[model samples]
Target: MRYESIVRNTEFSRAYRRGKSYVSPFLVTYVLRRKRGGVRLGITTSKKIGGAVQRVRARRVIREAYYAMGLNEEQSVDLVFVARTATTRVKMQKVEKAMRAHLTAAGLLSR
Candidate 1:
């Protein structure tokens, strides 16, 4: 299924300021519970990671991995995945694993 995306600057800022965060070699995740709406996701890749191509690849990998998780829920939450340098080189499964770990830590996923 497709995900509702976190598109506004305010939405992203709110998650960063109030969310619980988890870090892995491949990704950094920030999660916040929302009062209403479905799950909204954001993937961030910066110039520190690489040039345009690498940045795009990182976002794509994170998106695909997130999609594979099937974390659909009626409960509203915002998840932000920040791509690290390693994210560009790693396979999608690794990214997915990292994401699962973070979400689990945040209690978005079951143990």
Candidate 2:
């Protein structure tokens, strides 16, 4: 499922500055609550991940893993997914599992 994306640099900054962070070898997530809006998503991968091809693949994998989470577009949250070096080396299922653990710990998986 497609999500409302967090695109602007300011929005990304706001999430980084104010959101709660969940970190694992597979991924790093920042979650911020939105009082009245649907869920928004952002994904980031650095040069440390590799070249253009690898970065794109990391993004694609994270996106697919996120879709597999079955989250609705109507949730009251904003989520940022940062790909760690390990993210590109694992299966989508492993990424999904890590994402689930982080979200569950943040109490965002209850819905």
Per-model CA lDDT versus the true structure? 0.91, 0.91
Q: Distance (Å) between predicted and true CA of 98, model 1?
A: 0.6
Ten-residue region with minimum lDDT total, candidate 1: 66-75
Worst 10 residues of 2 by lDDT: 69-78
Per-residue lDDT of model 2, residues 1-111, tens digit only: 778899999999999999999999989999999897688999999999999988998999999999999876767899999998888889999999999999999887873
* Candidate 1 Cα deviation (angstroms), residue 89: 0.6
* Global fold similarity of model 2 (TM-score): 0.94
Candidate 1: deviation at residue 44, Å? 0.7
Clashes of 2: 0
